[model samples]
Target: MSLYQLVYYSRNAIAGDASVFEAEVDAILAASRRNNEAAGITGALLFNAGVFAQVLEGPLAAVEATFERIQQDERHGDVSLLALEPIAQRSFSNWAMGFVGHSAENAQRFAAIGLTRGFDPARLGGHKMHAILRDLTLEEEAAAA
Candidate 1:
């Protein structure tokens, strides 16, 4: 399977508040999983408060098509892709879609969050900043469900 690395930033409005944010997050994750499965894709999603960085693996065409749909999604109307390109590795092989949290320590490792302004396609400092949440297996998602 071909893999694509996609990264984007979202406004703070994406996470409006506690309860609403939880509900929205749940719904979005479910939708992502369904879409990925429908398109024969697998990937992990990382959220650093507002920004979203993801890696999708599947047929190249399927991955690109799904990303096109994502660009038009109203739920994340502010979604702005910083990068979309072929990748040599599949960071997530087992998950249809995974929304994993980056630890606070990891978040602080590469760059201070708020201080980092502007999204540069060449600056992949976020992923470099955290230890990815790939450790959560399908079993973990099921248990959470």
Candidate 2:
């Protein structure tokens, strides 16, 4: 079966403070893991600064359907669809919905991904956005390993 990848970024609905934001993120990851596991979706979700960037890869229909629901989700606004097309394989296959939390030192830690300029999904192009997401996801995997 052909695979599809959907990448997007949006402003966080609970961005004013850290405590609420962390709680919201935990809830999102838990729900996403449950849902994505059932749907056979493999992807990564990144929470950095005040934005959410995610990459969902799976069957064409499944990926598209999931993206539609994400678009309709109220917690996400100013959504920018970075990349949405076929892919040869899943970059996040080991995860139902892997997550990466950002901190003050994250920028320096992830500077190899060209994040030294800061992660601005709005200004970054599709290729660069995908690169960042891939790096973040792999970084998480490496950390776990």
Candidate 3:
């Protein structure tokens, strides 16, 4: 299967209590996992506050199809793609669907990789987390297995 990486950004507007938002987030993630697995695709989902940064890799057709399905997800709207590139490596060869919840520590780890200026708790939106996710696919590929 040809490997592909896709990136997207969208504004977060889930205005309510944290628990309400969390429940919605859980449902969205579950649907994503189901869809990807059915298509033989695997990757990771990184959610930081309201920013959704994901890297899905698998058969070219499946990658495209999965994104198509993602666009219709009610929890997310205004999706904007930042990048989509072909790579010569397989990052999550063994992961059917890996996930990460972004936090201060993860932000710091991303900064060390040169993807951003470093973890600034106040500037979470400014950090290039998607770049970090793309790099992690390879950086932690061994561990991912």
> For candidate 2, what is the total of clashing residue pairs?
0
Please give the ranking of all candidate structures by lDDT, highest first, separated by commas.
2, 3, 1
Estimate TM-scores for all models.
0.65, 0.87, 0.69
| Residues 30-120, model 2: lDDT tens digits | 8888889989899888776667888899998888888888888887789888888898988888999988767765766656554543567
Candidate 3's C-alpha lDDT? 0.64
Q: Please list the residue runs of candidate 1 whose C-alpha ends up more than 4 Å from where it truly belongs after superposition.
A: 1-3, 102-122, 125-145
Runs of candidate 2 exceeding 4 Å displacement: 110-119
Candidate 1 global TM-score = 0.65
Q: After superposition, how far is residue 123 of candidate 3 from its true place, in Å?
A: 13
RMSD of every prediction? 5.1, 2.1, 5.0
The lDDT values for all models are 0.62, 0.80, 0.64
Rank ordering of all candidates by TM-score, starting from the highest: 2, 3, 1
Name the weakest run of 10 consecutive residues (lDDT summed) in model 1. Answer: 128-137
| Candidate 1 lDDT for residue 94 | 70
Per-residue lDDT value at 139 in model 3: 51
Relative to the unseen true structure, what is the C-alpha lDDT of residue 61 in candidate 2, on a scale of 0 to 100? 84
Superposed by TM-score, candidate 3 places the C-alpha of residue 12 at a distance from the truth, in angstroms, of 2.4
Tens-place lDDT per residue, model 1, 1-145, is 5566655554545545667867877887899898888888887766654556566667789888888877776656566555566778765667888775545554563244332335442354435422233444343566678
